[model samples]
Target: MDPRESLIPPETLPDLLAPGLRLISVGLNPSPASVAAQVYFAHPRNRFWPMLNASGLIDETLSPSPDSMRRLFEAHRIGFTDLVKRSTPGVAQLRAADYRAGASALRMRLHGLAPRAIWFQGRTPWSQYLRYTSGEAPAAVWGLQSQTLDGVPVWVTPNPSPANAAFPLDVLTAQLASLANWLARRP
Candidate 1:
């Protein structure tokens, strides 16, 4: 299927979601490359998909395409969404209002879905999310936290954007491995 026909407008990628998900991975927002391609983590250099596979969170080396995402929800019991749905060249282009609105929407969405876990791909959105949900700033920490959204566990991980050279692919892969371990231990 033409991606355009299967997804939201190219300017805004739709959430890849389903009920009763084992995990719901949340990104800060869609990058311009992702928006243009109408695929999540579409940038050639983005490590999101590769890390997921490496960590055994996903069994297949999936591409950032509509079919793969559908399989992620249906077969893997995983879903993808973003704190912000808007497309921008970079996160630097996002404003405070954008984050506030995104956080609010995400809170409601998570509360309703009540996934087993909600994983934030970066510290930025996770911080904003804590503020949005708790009405106070949290000393953000990477990895699983004691926080929960509507009873769903919250996890934070390093951003996988190519621009984030601070955490190399190996580091991100390890982080994802931790997330997989957490999920495995869940009752």
Candidate 2:
């Protein structure tokens, strides 16, 4: 397939996920570029990978390719998933119904998988999770939350999308480092 094609591929990126992980990073949804490339956080401008490395969560930096995902899960005990499974050109393209259904499904999955902690990449997914599950849309704080998901701790951070310029890279990196520190202190 020509890489320039804007068509959403039949296949989207698969979740690099497993049960009993130390950390699970959740995204809002797949970007069209990520879908077309069949990789998570694959957009060239996306800083998820860079910030992940800077945080020192993993032993080394990882490429956002499917091939590198195994190392993340197997060695680092980190996994990835998204609140919504569908790919869109932008988050605005996602509907409320999509968030509702996705949040419900994610709740069930997290209950089953039982990761130690969940780090939501942005506020939307976490907010939708609270709204759908509890009927209250509370404002999100970008750090460890008071709530727990099936006994798993929840963390939030600014979205690393190139579109989210409000949080500087240094701030984002610091948030991730905080998360890393929290994980280290856990038994």
lDDT at 16 for candidate 2?
A: 77
Model 1, 80-155: lDDT tens digits are 8899889888988999889889989987777678788988999898998778767877776888887777877889
Candidate 2 segments exceeding 4 Å error: 1-8
lDDT of each: 0.86, 0.86
Compared with the true structure, what per-residue lDDT tens digits does model 2 show for residues 1-187?
7776755445556787788899998999999888776777889999888888898777787888876777788888988888999888788898989999989987877777888899999999999988988898889998999888887899999999998988888888999999999888898
lDDT value for model 1: 0.86
Among residues 3 or more apart in sequence or in different chains, the pairs in candidate 2 whose N, CA or C atoms overlap within 3 Å are: none
Off by over 4 Å in 1: 1-9
Q: For each candidate, what TM-score against the reference?
A: 0.91, 0.91
* Clashing residue pair totals per candidate (backbone < 3 A): 0, 0
